[model samples]
Target chain A: MKTVWTQKGFLIPAGALLIAILLPIFASEYALHIAVLVLLYAYLSTAWNVLGGYAGQHSLGHSLFLGIGAYTSTFLFTKIGLTPWVGMWIGALLAGLVGWFVGYLCFRYGLKGPYFALVTIAIAEAMVSLTNNINFIGGAMGLEVKWLGNSPLLMQFESKAGYYYIALVMLVIALWLVYWLSRQRFGYHLIAVRENEDAAEALGVDTLRVKIQASILSAFLTALGGTFFAQYFTYINPRNVFGEGPSIQILLFAIVGGLGTVWGPAVGALVLVPIAELARGWLGGSFAGAHLLLYGTVMVLVMLFMPKGIIGLYESIRQRLKRGSSAPEEERTPA
Target chain B: MSMLTVSNLSRYFGGLAAVVDMSFTVEKGEIVGLIGPNGAGKTTVFNMLSGFIPPTSGEIIYQGRRMNGLKPHQICELGVTRTFQVVQPFPDMTVLENTMIGAYVRHPNTTDAKRKALETLERVDLDAKADKLGRDLTLLELKRLEIGKALASEPDLLLLDEAAAGLKDTEIEDILTLIRQLNREGMTLLIVEHLMKVIMNLSHRIIVLDFGKMIAEGTPQEISQHPAVLEAYLGKDE
Candidate 1:
């Protein structure tokens, strides 16, 4: 608990945010677009980290909520002319309920580790199939938001800066939420459950309730990203929104950045997305999927060399540097 | 009339009975020792009392409330907490953070729980290593942390499973002193230990189990000479 004003650590984020706000003035539209994509992934991945990283419940099917958010808001906007700003909240609520139901079914029966991951993937796939057969919400073809040039009220923007700012604001809020939780009892309990469920239970932590709450929160926030995705792209098919690709992309950023840390996912997105986008831009004509190959290779290298992710690596390096500055405590021999 | 009362408790794994028709009552503020050889179901009984598993047929009444069917956390919330025979530390967390998890049961606020955990860590003589990660601790420190974690919850009754299982004689003596100090401070303890030195030195009353059945129950002195207890340990001469 040091207040934000007192802590020197707050400068990193503050500085980063300041840089992000001013970047639009000098940066090209392409860079801004990549920045928006980075922010969106960072937001979604941070939401994923609440359950996957902090609670040690790796969910690979978060696209279920993503699809829910995209479809809900899109359907409302397309069919009934409801504004997406209001519709996004409804999508978030629906995603939260589904999150609760999914969490209840999996955690109530003690499904954990790989089994829980499989169940989530299964559920998301089932949603994909269900959405495909349904006609009311455009089925497999998907819904498209009606184009309205420079319409702020409808969340459609003429320039990339509007979406960039929205994405930036969303990411900041999500990061702040995670930072706040990290200092709270819920965050501690989630880590406790992650470390050892039986030990946590013995310590009087309600593991099930903590985990379920994490699921609901993670799903709700991820659905918000889904709505943002729909608004930004103006088109979201079930395959793109609720498919395995989006789900994998979300968790990858969390994993690569740092599983449990507040800024890890954002850092992960910050580093990886630009590289992917740039590689595709530079090498697309010669090798269509070469950038993906590079991305996958980089991911493999990170997992092999930095399994705890970039944050863990940074922490260990800092610890070593600190130790180097002072005489370290003598290691006690085992009794 | 008792702090904890168990009646006709039994747990059968498939056709094999781990513990059967066992009953005991622990008075408040008393240090009770449960002793048995390996697979004698000492740990099984501890597991039942702490709500790690349910008994097949029986009742566990603690302070006038039935404990069966309740989750382990609920059991801990009701002023009962247990430590494992194998130490469990959150490896990624600092020692202070690990202890804080238990303090959080009573102190919901982070600052308040941290203060409480620090005090508990001091009580366990682990204050110096508060900043160390749980994974870096020595075995003796891990054991102390296990007890410190349970103590942080401020339990009315603490269940310690083999708290001194893998300690040197001097280390055992050190832990015995800690246990003695805890009892003197009016904390009730139910200990399951294979080491006679620990059980005899600490328990106010000792219960001996053989084949999951209570073979002897008495003060340490009386239980030492009890024939069934001797038979359970040394096996009938000739």
Candidate 2:
């Protein structure tokens, strides 16, 4: 019985991967642009899930790391003629260091729940203020990637297809990383820390260390999204990357999709992003505020009815169906 | 040889001294009972010993190594594990997974940890409900699962706080029997229990405390007869 469930679990994701890989083939250019937007949000949210979802540390200021990544790569590319491919790693490392610092400072003092969330917001807000006044990295004006036509090396391309494929590949890798995390010892320790800290400590989990590591990994992954954002859009400013708006948007997908599940954030982005795009495209001037209204309504309905998100709703239905199918067989064989 | 030696252990929460100048020693293999009236600091002692709270001034020597500066996980790695008075199970996880978190301390590999956790569940008589979520268990089952989780680390010494608290006669008896079976298998224990029957029946020696101070220490029979203990504990119990 367990083996059958396991086989189905593996096969479904494999089938979905195949479908996602072929989606671009039949998609219109405009549709593919929307697909890229979905993948980008999915990638960012999945990155946020390492700490915010699995470890239960809701960092409301994750845009701090995103901004760091964007500024780091953009500065390096514009100043030294360095490629973004190399600068991205350097940005990731810096973001990881900042993540470690922030995690240690907050967790060491036992800041948690709402206090931890507030600290992240404060730190991200501080970064935005600092960036606005700084003379380097284009200051308030922002940096635009030099558009050397069809130059893949500089992370600049002539078409949206190039950016779309890059975003797709990045999302796939992030998904694979999260999938691997769900099965490992570190993952279990992380979940344990989230469930109950004192109990996890009694059971020999170093909750502080686990939280720090998750923070660093989450920050590292989020920074990659930052670099991708700068490269794909060809422009990045303080408000676009480090602002409270994008920060909320990043966590929104994770919470609405289902917090802590491997594919839930991706699932959230897939459902919400396209609706947003299609709503705006179809309704344009006729319904100026229609998409926002629709989006807000869906969020409220999910929170009210499906508090555990869509994946949780699906899981309950699946369990009921399995039990329904197996009930009669058990009675006939034993009684 | 002493497995644990605590001297002058004290904890002050602001102006209030929760535990004061308390000292005790547990030999290599013995079940020691800690009994006291409410607010007598039994849980506070356990908290300090497990490294959850830093002692204001004291020394905790476990197997001849000073444990003052160690973290909770560090203490656990040294083969001393504890269970909370308030049963804490990872509510989202299954009983087996809850035990697996403890098993992961010694067995870093997932498959090996799962195997150990399964064995622990069987020992605690919870194998039948191993797949049930932690929050779904009855109070008796939750207590047993708590013990199973602590036992999964294969600790040389275990500290149990109120393991049999708030239970029926049969449920307490079931827990008492499980503790006895574990001790017979060579697990040493330092248990803080409220039930007189549980402490007096199982302890080789008993320590009695009142208002954060130890009033008596001796064999269970001697402790039951001590005048200070009588006034401090039995008076409060009645």
Candidate 3:
């Protein structure tokens, strides 16, 4: 309520938005593809941050929602001859329901911290193996999304620009959603539960409800990203889309950016995605998996500089600047 | 009239009895004190009353509703909330934000909850430190923050678990004043403390527990003079 958006805050985001909107218009195909990937990961990371960061519930099964989104919309479009735009929403709904069920069982049984993380990992892993064996769901062969050539109605496009813009829009929407949530009562409940469950509960917070709601909302958004990925890439597979790799990758974006902060994941995506892609390109044939080494090194360096992530580092610097220029430190830092 | 009724409450951690047959009633507007030595099941009793832990073989009735099987949040919503014996603050949050979390229980709007939280913070003299993160607060500040957060829930029966355990004498006096002020405003409190002087001055009635069982129950003067109470605190002479 105390005016979270300062003039500088408004200016920075507005400037960033202008750049993001205009970047696709004049970009080359390869650059646009990278931009699309960056936006896509930004979207997924934002989704994961809702629960993993804000609610303090680390979930490694987010790829399940992603696969569900991609699979459901793809199935509906291929089988029922429906447009993907509508199917995407249905996929989101189904994922939300599944997320709620999973969250309910976990919170109801009081699964917390590492145990909860394991359950999520186990669920995603099971989905991976199950999708591989299920014949109707394309089994290990995977599913290909058929594009009828440049149709806006189908949410498919011949130009990478379209996907880039769409992914950018998704990223923007996800960031706004997190910003809106952080300023709401429900958001406070999620953060409280995250900070200390017992204290939150004693103070009249419904920790279970907060966790469940966060899980569902997060899944819904992540699944929407999945649908977008399927539409953008024109293909989906259990091993690639629902694998532990995607789940971990998405979380890393949030973690590296600053887990609890609204724009942290988006910032993370913007900064890390391009660096990783460039590293991969530069290290293409000289050595296998060398790009990952560079990626890991960058992450380590960033963490060494700012242990809480980029957003945290920014906040601390800003705080110190304020204290330095305007006033004295109010009290000594706690020991 | 009884605001809280604990009948035959007992809690066992595996084979060890932490609270044994603890039965007491807190009146609607009195400050009731629970005092015992360390590990005397004081915190266990507080946990049961606040619905953090269930009583093994008893019932907790709060304002005509059963509270034994209820969750802590549910009990809080039923107008009973408590502070922890060991101070627990939401370290990442600002003082106002930490208090706002409790205020959110009643006021479902962010703006409204913040306003309520601010009012509660002011009550506990923490308004000046509202912008500071919980982790930045000093020890005494954290203790006040613990109480401030609990008070934000607007509970009819406030359970204070060792409210003045780690405070200096002057700091304890500040807490006593706050408790008195809250009681004067018609708030009922059930406090747990180790210090005799603090508890004797604040509580309308004092209950003593030893080995998870009630050793004495009376007014401050009476309880201070009770033989069983003396035996519990100082070993009985042969």
Candidate 4:
């Protein structure tokens, strides 16, 4: 059973990755654009999963960190003439600091569950309002990256495929990080805290420190995604990057794909983003927010049928198959 | 040398004392039991000692160091850790994974932590359940798995909150035997339990509580015969 699981785990992700790699080669420009977008969302959702999914702290304000990353890089490039690559790191560090403060305060004060979620939402809104008034970051007018015509250092690419590969690499890196974390003692400690905080305390897992670290890592990764987003679109606005919409979208992908699983966000992005994009393309403004209606209906069905998300559905079927195949062994064992 | 010293420890939950002016000293390698009726604050005392709650006033000196305001993980780092009365296993993780978290208190590396966890599970006779998810374990296995996890931290002074609670006689004896083996290996234990037989047999000395106050402290024979203990705790049986 264990071998089969291990084999399946490796084989499935490898198979999916092989397909994702070849997609850009045969795809039309529009399809390639959508693929890049899917990879972008995958990066965001996967980064969000570090805290929101594994640590079990649902933050609807991750966009605050996203905006922080976008603005920091955009300003560094436009005003200071530094490469976006360097600016990206600086933005990530700043986001990490902010996430640390937020996590420390929330965990220290015992804000959890829905209360924590609400605070995140409020923070995102506050960032949106703050960015609108900050004249240094171009204020409400937003910042536009000048087309440098295929400079690798600028992160401004000529083709959608360049952005696609970058986004794909970033997504893969985020997945690898989450995967590494899930196998660590630190990861188990997070799960322990998630399962029962009091129990985790007695058993000697430093609940506060672990949570704060998770928040910091989460912010750092999300910021990288934000940099990717800014580079891909070549434009940044407070309302677009730092809005509540991004948070909801990220959360929907993680929750619907599978909370607490490394592959859940990737799978979620693959399933949800394509469907919504295609739905939007098909509906074509005949009925406004029709894609959201599709999302709403799909999410409700997912919640109803698989509360543990899509992964739970896959798990149960595997269990049933194993149970069915084990009848002979069970009889032989005198059960 | 004393493994732990609790001097004038008191905990008040908004004007109600849960453990009032409690003082106790546990010697190295001794199994000490805290016994009381329900709501006598046994768990409260355990909580304060393990750093789950800060004492309203007093000291928790472990291994010659002041641990009064230290957090639980810091105290565990100092070789003091605990198990809960209400068993809490990370439901999503396997038994080995659960134990690995405790082991990680000392060994941060994944390979070392897993080896330590597996050793602890073997010692607790829970190696067979290593890969089983926590929620799938039966009641007896769950309790054993709880002990397995606690032991993985390699604590010098272990606090067990009602380890023998809700067990049949045979299962209780199995746990008691395990505790005895652990104690013989030089691990000091401070257990809170209501079961008379298990506590009497496993503990070298027992402290009895009534209404958040220590009524008696003696050998099992003396505690059973103490007038206050009989009147306040065991008396209810009559």
Interface RMSD values for all candidates: 0.5, 0.6, 0.7, 1.3
lDDT per model vs. reference: 0.94, 0.91, 0.90, 0.88
- Clashing residue pairs in candidate 1 are none
Determine which window of 10 residues in candidate 3 chain B has minimal summed lDDT: B1-10
DockQ of every candidate? 0.92, 0.88, 0.90, 0.71
Task: Tell me how much of the true interface, by contacts, candidate 4 captures.
Answer: 0.77
Candidate 3, DockQ score (0 to 1): 0.90
Per model, kept true contacts as a fraction are 0.91, 0.84, 0.93, 0.77
Off by over 4 Å in 2: A1-6, A329-335, B236-238
The candidate maximizing TM-score is 1
Off by over 4 Å in 4: A1-8, B234-238
Model 3 chain A: worst 10 consecutive residues (lDDT sum): A326-335
Better structure of 2 and 4 per TM-score: 2
lDDT for model 3 comes to 0.90
Cα misplacement distance, residue A89 of candidate 3 (Å): 1.0
For model 2, the DockQ equals 0.88
Model 2 C-alpha lDDT per residue in residues A171-267, reported as the tens digit of each score = 9899899988888889988899999998899889999999999999999999988998899888988888999988998898888889999988998
- Model 2 chain B lowest lDDT segment of ten: B229-238
Scored by TM against the true chain B, the candidates give: 0.98, 0.97, 0.98, 0.96
User: Which is better, 3 or 4, measured by lDDT?
Assistant: 3
Comparison by DockQ, 2 against 4, better one: 2
Top-DockQ structure, candidate number: 1
Q: Rank the candidates by DockQ, best first.
A: 1, 3, 2, 4
Residue-wise C-alpha lDDT for candidate 1, range A105-193, written one tens digit per residue:
99999999999999999999998899898999888999998997898899999999999999999999999999999999999999999
Rank list by lDDT: 1, 2, 3, 4
- The predicted structure with the larger lDDT, 1 or 4, is 1
